[model samples]
Every structure is written in structure tokens, then in C-alpha cells.
Target: MEGQAKGLLKLINEKGIHRNTKFLAIASGKGGVGKTNFAVNLAYILANDFDKKVLLIDADMGMANVHILVNVNTKKTLKDILNGERIEDIIFTTRNFDVLPGFSGIDAINEIDDSAVYKLVQNLNDISENYDFVLIDTSAGIDNKVISFIRASSKTYVLTTPEPTAIMDAYALIKSMKKLYDYSNFKIVVNMVKNEDEGIETFERLRSSIKKFLDIDVQLAGVIPLTKNLQKTVKKKQIISEVYPSDKFVLHLKKIAASEVGEPAPEIKEGFWDRVVSFLRKEG
Candidate 1:
């Protein structure tokens, strides 16, 4: 399966590995914020609709679900990579984007060391060089692993809902990450919104809290309204964008892509893996 996945990625990317890949980390303050759902759909749109090569990295560790959302069987995972398997070899190719499935559980996840993190970064950077975009679906909550992934990505998106607890959790995540790197590439996406006005108000509330308390501002990427059809697609293990392209949810996500992800980012001297190494050093 590993070899097959790499071969499939090669077929999609005939030019082989190259630099200039954009790393975008998607996180939720707490679970059930639709973080994985958003990541899967966004990756699908980029690869299937826009005709770009994309890799979706499931960094949720023990609670990986990107494969479940896409209904693909994964015989290998990041655990294999940590045990000396090449990062490129563990990829599980789906219909649209290639998925590097996160491990169900590994003791290392509870006690991962600097060398291990460095190894993951090195291998991820090696394979990520072949794509136009790499979407990291980070684990829920504000653990060290989740924080590390968010801080290392070129862009960070914090997912939230209109619920008060969810809003506070999102603010907490931003505060914790800001203490680490003072990242300016952060954005907010409000999901499961009931209406546009509610979404705007929710974002404004969160933004106000951050500004008044943390003295920093975050951009609102887009709002995804709750739709019954979205759940239907989830049950079917298919991307809502493909099954219901005309949905308001799909339309809003497209707006997010247009915001900045519609094309590859300009090349930079330092790359995603380099950023991870630097972040881990500071984290230590």
C-alpha cells in the first residue's frame, strides 16, 4: 500500500519532488469543531477542482480520522515513519489528495523527544517537496504536539464555533501559540454557523477578546454554515464539496481558497521542515 501510494503521487506529480510547497495547519481548540472535515474538503477542492497536487497530513496522532472521512484503508501510518519507514512510503493515496495518515497510537506520542520530532520534520520535508500544498490536520486540543504542528505551518487556522466554550478555547489556543512564536500568519474559521450575521458576530467577539486581552488581531478566513447534507456526505465518507458543490458550505470554503490558497505561495529561503526544526529548538 505504501509503494502504491507513492506511485500514485508520482503519477499525479510527474515532475517529482520540488520546493515551494505551502504548509497550512488546521487546528481546533477542542474536538468536534469540524477541523478534519474542513481539511479533507479543502484538500479535495485544491486537487480535484483546481488541478493542483496536494498532500493532506493527518497529524491528529491517536485520534486520526482523515482516512475515515475519505473511506480509505491505511495499512501504514506515521508510526511506521517513526519506526524507520520513509515518510513518502507511508502515504495513503485517496481519490484526490494523498493522505499521510496519522497513527492510531504510539507510546512515542506520549513521550516524543526532540530527535523524534526532528526525524518527523526531516522526513515530512523530504516528501512535502513534491506538492503544491500540504494541509496538516492537527490534533484537537492544546497539547504540545498540536501546538508544535500549528506553529510550524506557514499559515495557521484555528477552527471554532459560535458556542461560548468553543470561542474561549480558540482564544486560549491563540494565546498559548502566541507565547511560543508570536505568529502573525494565524487566521480564524468559524464553523457550524447558523447564519452569516451570527458568524460575523462570533468572529468579532473572538477577535475583540484577543485584541483586548492579547493585544493582537486575527483574520477571519471564512464561515461554514451547518447543513444536513454535510452530515450525509460524512456518513457516506465522501467530501461535501464533491457531493454538494452548490452548498453554501462549499461556496464559503471556496472563498477561503480565493483568499490566498488558490495558488502556490512565493518561494521562500527557509522551508516547512526548516520551520519545524527551528520551532522545536525554540520549544526546547
Candidate 2:
């Protein structure tokens, strides 16, 4: 199995990475590791630095807080879509990108039945076509909802810190990615690192473990340093990327935006949203 996996990974590399990546999921194995903050800043960098039309979807469900980070007092969400509001009406525009704020009352994802899923999939597809990138800030941990989003997305960037627990949970998340989703191609963002060496070591530790156990492919997207008054900026309800464009962490984000991302230039596996539509149809 390990040999076969290596052969498949070699073939994937020989074919080059897929370029027409439309939906990207930013997720974590545990909360409070700055996953949402990373997603928000990545969207900003992709839009402002790379000139991509980006949409950041706050898909954290019951713990939605992208609005708080961006200082947008949003009133409508997926719930409002059921009340006859168009998805376009619920989107809040920002300086660099757009946001579809998540619903934050209870576990709203459970309340979304097949009909609601169908409605959301349709509206989401319609709106998503206009943008170059759609970043879903998924809820943390190995929750089924998070798995579904990661499964549906074109790319998954698992966020982790240098903390031992974060690394352990990140490996667990990768295991679930392969076990539950039958997916293993993942990009890792080691955030809040003390230095470059620490970041590289952290990624290597996670990678070696994953290679020994999961036999999966994982790429280091980039490393964010523990620089700047990031928490203070977050408290101001502002994105650090925008607030401190010259910060080391923001520069690392820019590096990821430029190197890890590209225009939708190549053909991609189409009908992902349609698959969701079909699932909704079957459920209904």
C-alpha cells in the first residue's frame, strides 16, 4: 500500500497540481488555533495582492465569528435563505473580498434539511461562479459537518500551530481526511511559529508521522511567524493582513497566496456543486 501510494503521488506530481481550484476549505483539528483568522487574511491577500475575486464563507456554523473579525454586523445567513432572501442579499462586501456570514444560532447545519441544502447549493453555485476563489472557514475538529465541507471542497488547508496538541490533532484530522473522505492531498499552514526553524521542524514532525502511518501527501503551504500584535488587531475587529501589511505573518500569507494559489486556468473536476445538488435530491 505504501509503494502504491508513492506511485500515485508521483503520478500526481508528474501531472502537476490542479490549477482550476475553485472551492478551498481552511480547517483545523481544534479550535483557537487561528483558523478563521488565517482564512480571513488569506482571502484578503488573494484578492488584494493576487487580484483574485474572492469570497470568504463563514461556515463555522454555531460558532460563526467571521463577522466579528471583519466588523460586519450581519443579520441574515443560511437561515434567511429559507425566508425568501436571495443569497446575494445576504452577502456582505468588504474592501478586498466578499463574505457569506454563517448562521450562529444553535447548530444550524443540522436544521438545514434536504430542501435547504438544495436551495443553498443552487444559490451558492450561482454566486460562486462570479468569483475566482471561495474559501470556506470550516468548523474545527473531526465533526461530520466539517468532513462534509472538506470533502466537497477542491482543496483543503489544515491549519495548525507548533503546539504539541495542535500537531497531534492535526494528524488526527489528516487521518479522518483519508478515512472518512477518502482524500489525502492536503496543504498545511503552520501558524504562530516562533521561528522559521521551528515552523519547518513542526511541519516535518507532522509530515513524518503522517508518512509513517497514513502514507498520505501533504504540502507545506507556508509558515506564519508569531510576530505583530495580532491579537490586538483582532480585538479591533480588523484583519491583520490589512492592518499590518508589512507584518511577517501577513507577508507569509502573501507568499502562500502567490505560490500556493493560481488562476483557474486549467480544467477541473466539474459538477462538485451539482454533486451536492444530487445529494440533496436523493435526500429529498
Winning model by lDDT: 1
**Candidates' lDDT values, in order?**
0.82, 0.81
lDDT of 2 at 275: 59
What are the models' TM-scores?
Answer: 0.86, 0.86
lDDT of 1 at 181: 65
Residues 93-185 of candidate 2 have per-residue lDDT tens digits of 997799998875424544567677677678877777777788999888875454666767777899899999999999999997797658885
Candidate 1: tens digits of C-alpha lDDT, residues 64-172: 8898999988788878877788877789778668999887643454467768777877787778778888999988777655566677677888899999999989988
| Clashing pairs counted in every model | 0, 0
Query: Which lDDT value does model 2 have at 208?
Result: 95
